[model samples]
Target: MLSLGVRQLDDILGGGVEEGSSVAFVGSIEYDNVILMHQAVLEALKAGKRVLVVDFRQPPSTLLKELRNHGIDYEPFLDDSLTILDGYSNLYGQGIQGGRNVLPNPLDLGITTAIIREALQGDEYDILVIDDVTSQYTLQSSPKIYIKAVVRLVNSVKSLGKTTFVAVCSDVFEKSDLAAILIPFDYVVEVSKGVVEVKRSLQPLRVVEPKFAYMRTRNGISPMKEHYQSLEGLKAQLRAGENGTIWLKDLRVQILEEVTERSLIETVYDFLGPEKGKELLYTWGKKQFIGYGEYSKRHNTSIEEALEDIFKFTIASGGGKLELVELSDSVIIIRGTNLFPSGKGYPYPFHPNYAGSLAQFLTEFTGERWEGEETKCEAMGAEHCEFVLRKVR
Candidate 1:
């Protein structure tokens, strides 16, 4: 199987396209099928696989130039690993000057079929891509002839144990005719507007809903997720004096591990002294709270909702088991079990800086100065840890 290079799309494709499989991409004008094909070609080349691309939209030189403009280095792979079947030049009675395999009469189904079969005879290619297969019907007498030629070519490549992708415009042929033509393919995907939907597939028995939106980046095209869109929206808001979400575990790990060599408790005590360390930790927590506050404001969510997410993130990161016992306009109380406490007869009952961090976070989140105290402690021979935050007037 060949990876599509897009993780989510690959998952939807039942772990990528298998060799000898026929996949069709039916795209509307709003969708850029060539870009998708380009991405696939780049991926195949990167995997050190021999690729044969039959270009129907543009001359081989034009295609190579476009690939270069997209930051793809086609020089090293040309002729050796990557081959292009120039279909555009022949249609206009132009002689192929570039070192490309000329499809003498691309409009003729018989000749095109013969050339494709001859090229695939040696099993030299891992992938055979026919870009814009609909272009073959441009001057044809009947769509049936072009359809038969496509099916034959795909089957021929399949017989050679090679993967084939045939791209076609969704609106080019009548609905019934298009369905009939696509019926022979193992997979049929439709790209319309910005959404990519699986119209037909042999595997991935259960299809996922909310068809993916394709997003193009410097690297290439990939399926975009809702969270990613949300992040972008949030980023726009932040740029306009707003805010958003953070990967809490990554932040926590960075602070607790990368930022310091000592343990969370020891670092706080030695660097800032117990009294100052608590204040510093509280300030750090407040910054985190403030960041989340902006996200809540922009998202039209309650501060408590943001806090719930923070609590969930903390627990998920194995910080400890934290429970929100009480939450109000004026005060908040949370109880934690297995809270990281200093081991073996340490002076503190719990990590002092952690208490400070929690205090500041609550203070900023509530828009008021809040004093936090660890009323119950595990290090002090208590069963669990409890933190109480009281509004400080």
Candidate 2:
């Protein structure tokens, strides 16, 4: 458990971030997210741990002066532990050794990577801060590419048992999807006006603080603090999981009695390795469906209608090949095979558009993914017994 500079904030959050999580301080220039992050660093520094601020957003003087004025001896903060990678977003270098700052060219991540790698090699720091990634978001042509690399880098840091947080602003992105995609976050934090709100997925959303809730009641900072309530509400949703994702699929998918739906959707696949975007489609034509007991009064008409809907699409358009060949009548297997269509390759070629979407969906929805070529299988009857390796892909 880690503690923020403020005891209350740390207590509200799960004692700081879970290891290897890319925490985000999603705030813009006016929102004072930088100040909040500084406070977090102050807490870490007070704990006798080193802090590093990868400052692509601001010059050191102003922020250092601000902290000094706050009765903080920021010079020591800057002594050897605190790092300000000022102007690196615009400073393009040939490599880490090439310290020449070429502002005209794009930020050279190759150079930045080497710098970070060398710094990380020394095991002295516990927390790193990348404040306001909007500049980096704008600097990169495709933000996701850079973001994936950054997450890998963060993972490297976490392997050493350190913590890292990136600052992001909602308005920084043209679309929310891109924001969600870019930041590989374990938790999301929003600091608006003066208040800080904390939320976590795979955990709980705790209202750590109401920075401006009181100010709003007295007199709000229109436009600046207008989103205060909204941010708080949005922060509340963090523990809830991915903006309605929790309820978007309140799916009760119990594959009972060895049904087709059970056989198709209940399968599990490994979820590690470089070969991501792999998928094994059981069928691709339409949304899948199932049936109920024929004479059971409890059987609703909708089940049959839904099954009919599933059958309505023919092989040409709907029920394409089930990724797995008929293996032992009851058990079938498929390995992800396509990268573009799905994030991973599927056992069979899927419709180009739907492949990637479905692979990502199943992984998140049902903890499935295609990892290696070899797969282990168990019969529907032998649900407990496993271990038959089959070469896939």
Candidate 3:
């Protein structure tokens, strides 16, 4: 219903960009966050707002033109409402360059911010775009400097009700630090590879906010076709028997330290749908991260060549779905994203479990008896274990 002007993205983000907010685009992701910034600027422009694009990475013209190919219309910017700062950084390691010339080179200032500020000082723009926050973080002095820069730049534009989108991808290298800068923004849109996902980081309106969810690419990268078959309209094949290739167009795999009936398959999806239940299984081998060599030794497998060969597994039909397998009494089994060979009878926690645990860590889920869920203590050579895990849900 709303418009960011980026067709599908606007739909995904639920309307246009919020007036004044900073969206940190994590660079490490296959989808470069900076590219999203460009899209935001183009969106603001289509909304008839003057946009300022400060690019420490590249010239706005080039970047803007690039956006044109990716579904953003830039004719308006060519008509003037958009301004891009070009080559504003001379701070290449041993030197610091301002507007005029290279300085004595202590590298105390982030030239990008200054260029943006000066540009904005003259015009009453409605939206501001910072190509990226990485250059500044890499060149600037400390975290305090970055925070102050972001706060000042963000608040300054916000006072005028102008929306600002700053692309900072290098933040993933330091999550604790990113939390400080990114958590303050009202809306966040991350573009990875071809996937565009949005989250309401700090919503002021509070009407409706988006949560973090998995994004899949269909037509190209990251996003499935709008009219593509619904998740339910698919089949899956987990086992390698009569159902040679079980079509699991919408297969959702889960993992845990110890595969319990609860954690193994918490809920049964509607099997009537084309893609019903296609779950992968694994165990939480150990909580600690010992080196691969040591880990392999502890599990009686070569650190280099380890997989489903050394695990136990079982499959049963549930809700009419074929592959409803569970890894009972196991640990360190790989699942989800194929980070490792994960399946039933495995002896280690799967990728999905690690991911869930990671999510638990990020969201700070409730603390419950996770270790106690499957075992009283680590039963030595025992069988059929059951334990309760305290989770935040």
Clashing residue pair totals per candidate (backbone < 3 A)? 0, 25, 43
Give lDDT tens digits, candidate 2, residues 190-299. Answer: 76765566645435534323222212121112122222224342232234345443421233222124244333432323332213322343223112311112221121
Best by TM-score: 1
Displacement of the residue 255 alpha carbon in candidate 3, Å: 34
Sum up the clashes in candidate 3. Answer: 43
- TM-score of predicted model 3? 0.47
Candidate 3 residues lying further than 4 Å off, grouped into runs, are 5-14, 27-29, 59-69, 73-76, 87-115, 170-172, 193-197, 201-222, 225-393
Ranking by lDDT: 1, 2, 3
Q: Give the TM-score of candidate 1.
A: 0.59
Residues 1-393, model 3: lDDT tens digits: 214434445433544545555555555544446545555565567767787666665444566566655666666565388665544344443354454322223234555456456556755566677666665666555766676677777776666556677776753437766766765566766655444556554433222223222333221222333222233212222323343443233443433343354343333223322122222221233232214223323222221122221121111222111111232332222222212222354333223333333223222211221222222111222232222333232
Query: What lDDT score is found at residue 353 in candidate 1?
Result: 42
Q: What's each prediction's TM-score?
A: 0.59, 0.46, 0.47
| The best candidate in terms of lDDT | 1
> Cα deviation in Å at residue 103, candidate 2?
11
